[model samples]
Target chain A: MTPIALADYDVVYRRPDALTDVQTHYCPGCTHGLIHRLIGEVIDELGIRENTICVAPVGCAVFAYNYFNVDGCEAPHGRAPAMATGIKRVIPDRVVFTYQGDGDLAAIGTNEIIHAAGRGEDLTVIFVNNANYGMTGGQMAPTTLAGQVTTSSPYGRDVDLVGMPMRVAELISTIPGASYVVRRSVHNVANINKTKAAIKTAFQVQMAGLGLSMVEVLSSCPTNWHMSADGALKWIEDAMIPVYPLGDYRVADAVEPLTKRRRPDRSQNGSLATIPEE
Target chain B: MAKELWKGNEAIAEAALRAGVEAYFGYPITPQTELLEYMAREIPKYPGRVFLQAESELAAVNMVYGAACAGVRVLSSSSSPGISLMTEGLSYIAGTEVPAVLVDIMRGGPGLGNIMPSQGDYFQMTKALGHGDFHPIVLAPSTVQEAVDLTYGAFELAETYRTVVVILADGAIGQMMEPVVMPPARPVMTEQERADWALRGAKDRERRILTSLHLSAEGLERMNQGLQNKLARIQQKELRWQETMTDDADLLLVAFGTAGRVCTSVVSAARRAGLKVGLLRPISLWPFPEQRLVELAERVQQILVVEMNAGQMVLDVKAAVAGRAPVHFYGRMGGVVPLPDEISAQIDKLVSEPAGGTGFKTGSNNGYGQPKAMPAANGVRA
Candidate 1:
């Protein structure tokens, strides 16, 4: 019953030092917590946790600042990319990233993200696509899957009226300024491990002073999706992958060397993860 | 420093550099494009400086908000429509209590009025710059030298109050060339200095969070109360004004920016014509020179408020005068500039009238509006 009463017990795992001890307000089965952990781990691995600035967007992850033990700025809806650009430009020595969700990125902030990637701002973007506006109570998002049911799309999203969902990774990859653009999911352990690698690679590209690097993670929102925790994870693999198509949308010439091979002595967590060749 | 003929917009850009502006973010807008151009060309010359031409006013202002949150000296310049798009970011910056300098080189408009200089943004600048219970420190410069001077001092004021400082100039001041003795460059904010409130990183310290959002009522109200207290301190200590012939005067003319520039001549011509007239030009428009105006209102006969817009600042003048003196408004709408003679005629009417008459509202104000069309200018149509 007293699990940790024995101080002599071995500590198998610990929260990444980049993350604060505060409990997240994320709902059960919400993968924002998972994404935050992956980012924290990446920062902890890169040893840039102290020199990293996080830009928080207006969404479920608006308080991402509270969970991250780094300097942070809470940007307006859809404005995180611009804020990241601002931070990176002013403090180029510091690592900067933006944590944005579907409504914050695909819908309201399309302009800022597009231009940020277009200009090749030396910043990292962790965009979480959950197919709905999670914080705003499951409204139809720009990334809302076609024919998906939601509050705003009560009769399901009609492609004729609202148009097709935006594939942000593919769109951003077309910009010459974007050095690394990819989409990954957290539906299962394999994909979760891959998503963590992609997140780490993004920070690596930024650290290398390459260009705008974005890792769009397909996250699960069980509460908003009106599904059980297990069902939301399964839905990403069954329904989300077909539309999103997890793949490397863009890898600039300079980034290939870093991506193609795993550095010899990496993975302090003891999991040698690899990007899905697909 | 030797005086050199510098264009207003360019003077502002150089002044920003002298103030050691760390970043410049803006979109190209008429009468203020030179400022952005100058930055684009020169920001790179400095070892580590930033110059970004944002996609739109909305994007530009947000970039400004981002840079401001970093606790650096940043600048943005735009005319009316562009400034309108910036309202959202300005509000967030105000709530966040960050320092930023905005130079609003006013052209004309409630709409696409003209490229002609007009003080139409008086209400927009001094009153509702952005929504919320907040106010920006507004400095309206009357000439190019003054514009440079204000641009030099604005950053300090903004950082001092941790608020936005808007250097309000019009197209005339922005476009015209004037002799300016530029101030030497002040040292840029050091990293140690910025660590006080900037969001650079959490190195060797607790993380810093700069956010305006407070979901709970108590939290937001406390922030608002703090903002109000800061504004009160600004209003008390930062009221600036320039008065001439007010030592013994019957009629005092109230105006700012270009209106104030022209009224100086109007007052001189009126005085030459045997009238005891003075000009009370307000330099700091937000703190508003209200107390000074109220004090002067006690001695003056009828306070005449002159502007290039349709009676905006007169409202504040009236509120401050509070019937201590009767306030009459003389303004030219549709981006029309009120000539000295036109203002003098209005003053003549006010002086000749025995007691009470809405002296300048008799449709004759449109006289200036009729001839507003020029080859390069907009607004007047055939």
Candidate 2:
């Protein structure tokens, strides 16, 4: 009798083809899996799975090379931007990207990421900001918020001793080579959809031959943050967003047209439809 | 097409370009700054080539790691301090088994040592450049011409073994100007050639992931053993040394790089003075030419090891001789180069010594064993 109502349902969820069929090592409530899925979906949608290369950073995402179905290589801690720059410059046609964690990007790799952005390397960077060093246990990362308690900063983070937390997206946006720098989050379905869109736009910026593009996603770290999965998601909304606001920090003129064309109405068919006169 | 006068650093940079290097990532450091400059100037002339002045030596080495992983010839250069910054990257490159060139125009150092010519990196290059049990194929060049030839061939050897190869030069060699003929240009790997191993894309095959982190102890042990085997093969095939007058001489001098050049001049003068003096220069410091050293020790009465450092290579020479002959050492450290006369004077002193032969001896026992006297030749010390 219940079969009569089955016609009302529609297919709405499926795994991205660019992701391998394997279990992730990320802990429950961790957002790395979501971010990985978003990137895989972006690669699948853009039809770049076979022409894409990824440089996995050294932090928690060191084994990300195993998760992505595209060809990849491991970059030593904090050197993904420089590594991606080298790969992109050598083979400009390939769609190269780097996936990095907050500690890897804002701490040991600050110089590399900054230099790569300043050089306007044509690549996409997915920067996950969890505010703590997850790979080596809960250490005080460069992005650790002021007054936030971490294993290394057990006394609630002395601002006088160590500097305030870094705002990576805003800082990166100041570089002239960066064409698109946006800060997004992945918690609920709506926010997750927005994160996916931001990643796709970053990839589009690369495909369009624009300058460097990066998307900084405020992700949850339940294990390191000492919170349950739901609590961590709530913490990102209540605590993290106030310090690191979510918004597009830079959308250079070269990427504006692509962003406009990326809207759903124009992206449906194989060809991009010209906008009608207003 | 005549030979041109080029600085040691610039010549190495040009030779890398001609050897089909497609990417160059380097940081500016004393003695080797000209090399980075030359790359910046020349890379633009070649299409598809990349030249990036990295933020630091660490970044530069990692950039080479990335380019090398993509199956292209790439390299980086640095001075002593800068090369020290690259130690971690070098170890990672070794663990990943990626092919690339590292040029170290060594300066004096244990820490921020002066930018003068020094052979202080002999142990760093041969024994351990970074954490882990791995060996890089180290090439020592004594002349600008040899520098060009060695730099040109370094890329090939690196690719053949899928390991890092070092061109170990001193500050003086990097700064000196000498005539050198650049090797003929070779084409960079074609797209098809690179596709064989490069992480360019997974279009025709399964995805490839280049990594060095093997978490399991057994997995890492296997990787270590594989690296050991590769090193053993290189040692067997790439031992290079030059023997001058050692066939009929009673006294032999051991040196490398600029120190070796000075020793050659000393040998010429000693031969003119009716002294049976000869020279043996090691071109590959890591493989070390130990077999050849043993052969020469069997024939020579005494061996004198000279260098710009206090006494680095002497230990190696002593081990190879293994008490077969007495080994004496003379050196000038702290950026001071030992002049040919200074080395010749030491040679004269050793030749004039009594039957004990300068009291520096290592026989059949290992390096740490007790030293014994060299056998007297015709009851006199040869």
Candidate 3:
């Protein structure tokens, strides 16, 4: 029998089932969904769906737990890093990560993030940098550009008072324990692919037990940026990328396989058992 | 039988070890410093137990916070000023209902109060020590034996109520030495027992979160109400006190912790002097022995309250008595502990007076009624 030739094959390019069907709380043209998709694809590909633990930050993505199908915890404002530390320490075998925005990671939580990286904790962090605080209606952020205007800075950010925008990828790259640090963007198809690669690499570094890894994604917030979705994409490409160049800030040439080496089992060694009462 | 002569602080450490404590995180401070020192030496000797000498009181408490969030048995101990520094962490633990134990070996307070024995932290322990509407289960131990027994009790109550349990003692009790029969060893939890909610290496389960903050007003109110309900259950089941000869006494000595020990001697002396005196010793300071005091108030004409501070527990005693009988108070401040003879003298004065007349009573014909008793000769026998 001759095989029948079909002219068309049906396929849908919609949201993943792991993602909620409800409308997003994010502004139109915001790159949060694109980043979410990249993370979801990686989670699905790595077969870590059941064991992965995510700490949601207190920002635009505070309700991220509702959208992600994996286990998630909502942390206090600027405390996602510390919360992630707690989760990772107690469950060292679990693949734990924190998703944070510029305001949540760079300002109030700077100490927590710095300490976690310094300690070389085995965890991953996904930092979304939109140059402003989105959920609080576009206030100034630690990453807001020199001349950008926000609700708190009506005359635009003054370099003298607030200082220049921080380059977090570059900053974290200097940390000795940071196994992998990269900066990526989500403006277009080409950049989206690069961001996905960066996220995958960061997770792979964590799985390898190299230590702390982070991916900083430059995203767009069109409503807060006072632009249309297309305009916001254009603005991110034209204005944001120049100041925050995207690339791997620090990458290890080769990492030891995490599975090859077995961690000392404190339990098997009779370390965690109760001692006789004195 | 595990019998040993132990310092009050060391006995507490031994009790915690026997109770299957998983970790001990602490900073050194006077009086209670032995507790941490002993833990630092002993905990490491036990294969599974961890003992950390933290960078500061802040760090010690946070380390405890970390261990507690992981749903393990952890403890921290300090003196008065150190406990003040721990209030922030304690508040978080209480607000989040993390099960843990804190031992406060009380010293003088209000500022850099002396490191000698004083009950100045009575209010801080029984009342909310931190900034919020939260209360910890406060246990006051009068003797070294009680120190061991109550510490064990604190851990059990903490897990049962899912709240912070405080063993509130003074320098005298914390530093004093006595014989103790240690408790039997507790069995470690099986993997299945802790696998449900513990954060241990998240395997094939949802992430667990431990936090105290709730953004919404209604959410916070609900949390507060839930905590109150738990506390009510504790009150019904955990209220503890000791009564001696209150059945047919004209005078009752109400005290707690080290003060109760001193009051015992005073009661004996008052009895010998032909004054019917008994003692009401409170073990639990939070669910306080209020009902017991009220019941005693009906039989006794006067209740003499002794403490090592400036009238903190006296307020609770007054509230318990409710004016049915006079509540007389004798206290010393700045780490000066009143002796048994001084307390006995105070008892004599109260018993000789009319019913419903306190030392602090105003406009009394007796010159130096309250203020006169203040600078009494140090009545400790040479």
lDDT tens digits by residue: candidate 1, A1-278: 65667588555457989999999999998999989999998898789988999999999999999999999889988988887777788878899999999999999999999999889999999999999999989999989999999999999999999999999999999999999999999999878888888898999999999999999999999999999999999999999999999999999999997687653234445544444453
Q: Candidate 1 residues B157-204, lDDT tens each?
A: 999999999999988899999899999988787876773888877878
Cα lDDT tens digits, model 2, A35-101, are 9998988898889999999999988888898999999999888989988887887888999999999
Candidate ranking (TM-score, best to worst):
1, 2, 3
Better of 1 and 2 by TM-score: 1
Instruction: Please state the error at residue B322 of candidate 1 in Å.
Output: 1.0
Per-model TM-score of chain A alone?
Answer: 0.93, 0.91, 0.86
Candidate 2 clashing pairs, residues 3+ apart or interchain: B322-B362, B322-B363, B322-B364, B323-B362, B323-B363
Best by TM-score: 1
Cα shift from native, residue A154, model 1 (Å): 0.8
- Candidate 2 per-residue lDDT over residues B1-382, each given as its tens digit: 6899999999999999989999999999998999999999999999889999988888888888888888889999998889888998899889999898999999998798899999999988898899999889999999999999999999989999998899999999999999998889999988767636678799968999888999999999998999999899999999998988888878889999999998899889887777778999999998889999999888877788888887888888887888787677788888889998887777666666542445443223334333333333223433
Q: State the TM-score for model 2.
A: 0.93
User: DockQ of candidate 2?
Assistant: 0.77
Error at B9, model 2, angstroms: 2.0
Per-candidate RMSD, Å: 6.5, 3.6, 8.9
